[model samples]
Target: MNKRFIKGTMAALVSMLATNAFAATEVTVYTAFESDILAKYKNAFEKTNPDIEINWVRDSTGIMTAKLLAEKNNPQAEVVWGLAGSSMALLKEEGILKTYSPKGLDELRSELNDPQSTQAWYGNDAFFNAICFNEIVAQQQNLPKPTSWEDLTKPVYKGHIAMPNPASSGTGYMQVSAWLQSMGDNQGWAYMKDLHSNIAHYTHSGSKPCVQAGMGEVAIGISMASRGAKLKTQGAPLDVITPAGIGWESEAVGIVKVSDAAKRVVDWSISKEANELYVEMYPVVGHKDVEASVANFPNVQQKMAKMDFARMGNERADVLKTWSDKFDGKSEAK
Candidate 1:
């Protein structure tokens, strides 16, 4: 071959390699993680993979799930980073989730992994129900600190409480379901009936009830303990109470179908670096031995009720409907 021809071939190969290396891959991620933590998660991911940019669409769990379901036919999200496991199960049932187990998946607890053939979603961390009591407000109102779920039903707490609405918040439904599972259906209903009389409001956002309590809008707020602890650490004068028995949900991740871009994102999501980031925010990571605590997180993990994720997903719709029929749209005092 002529020298010029050989040089041209070498240059073509070099250009091809350069083009592949410089190609930017962007992934669209839909998540339910709080807005405050979005920047941190995004920045950490970007720091390691500068070539890939993450476009996050964050919202409350219900709204995010509904959006994903609505877009099922023509999926947009490449991956779901932090969402309720139950919501992912619903999506999996609809065949919208792509089953690709991430690296270090075996390190996760068995119960946290997907059992079905497709293995639709993976667990990141567990979030449980707890109460946020405004100590100052509770004392001023002469209210007794709540020690158990039943304590919230006392006549003393009447018209001084807030909780998430089951119809709108995943945490809300989980609490109701946990009660039914723990207290038995009949007793649970009875308990809720009594507790309902005291509820000041039913919030649409799962984390807002605690936020409202942290702000002293209500003397007591029923919400996720993680949010409560985080708030309390921020000088909210909020006392996070993990009643004797509490409901829990896992923050989960899943790859959305219909995107080659999403597959790539999921591939990295299950890697060691990604799990490390998850551990920073959530103490209970699925991959075994990645246990680390967030500041101000109490030893509430030991108190969590044994969750039945399969049953929860199977009966979620019925449970929500029953809860709505029984409590939603009803007038309550604040």
Candidate 2:
């Protein structure tokens, strides 16, 4: 080839590369998914949809919810994946979510998707509150194994328990909501008041309490089943206890009312492939056909409380306010 022709070809190639890069859609996704699994989900999605890229903004559920609501006027997120259903419901009420039913919406369990005709969100997987009792730690502290939520308040367990702060953790909120629904509002608050006297301190993250328990920092952790299961598998000397009638929250996805890429992400999020990926980590997935049984994690559906999640979503602010007023000062120093 002539030197002039070679130079022209190189220039054209560079310009084409730039154009393609610009043409590839970049969707900003906000999520409260565990940091360890975020990259895996992103990679899995990108592998299938090579033309689109996901930019993840990850945090604890409460922080993610607050951030989305705060950015309501000028929304930045194109989609929300792995947020708690309660938070998604609140966002829907605030008019922050756009309705777009994913392709496999009918294939999902009826309770897993939004019931509205104009669906704003759909669940991917679920996680629920559980007690992580470290056998070694409990033995060391001369503590008995706690079998129920009521057992945690016993004097023998005083100052040997750690729990997440509801103000910050989705797991924490689930626990609180479950108690209220299961035990009635007045009794639940009374129970918490007694439990508060025995608590060592409340951590900000849901999984932290279980991690602390695994390391023998506390005898018991009021945390999630999946975290406790993972810790036990790693030889944490932990017992992952799924107490009966405990509250659980689905890790859900919703489209923000912005970006052309939002619908695409939402569609993929509820696909069979995505459901397969989600089940690898969570016991319950949106799709009824996808069944998961993580070792050391109990069958959550059998134990989950009959909660009115919509009511929980509506009452979230008030419940958190009541909890904060009662226990915020007792939280461990950050």
lDDT of 2 by residue, 27-78 (tens): 9999998899988888998898888999999987778889999999999998
- Displacement of the residue 147 alpha carbon in candidate 1, Å: 1.6
Q: At residue 281, give the lDDT of candidate 2.
A: 80
Largest lDDT belongs to which candidate? 2
Q: Candidate 2: what lDDT?
A: 0.87
211-308 per-residue lDDT for model 1 (tens digits): 99999899998997889989988999988888766888887788885455565566566666667777877777776767786776767767777666
The Cα error of candidate 2 at residue 219, in Å, is 2.6
Q: In model 2, which runs have C-alpha deviations exceeding 4 angstroms?
A: 1-22, 115-117, 136-143, 258-261
lDDT score at residue 286, model 1, on the 0-100 scale: 71
lDDT of each: 0.81, 0.87
| Clashes found in each candidate (C-alpha, N, C closer than 3 A) | 2, 0
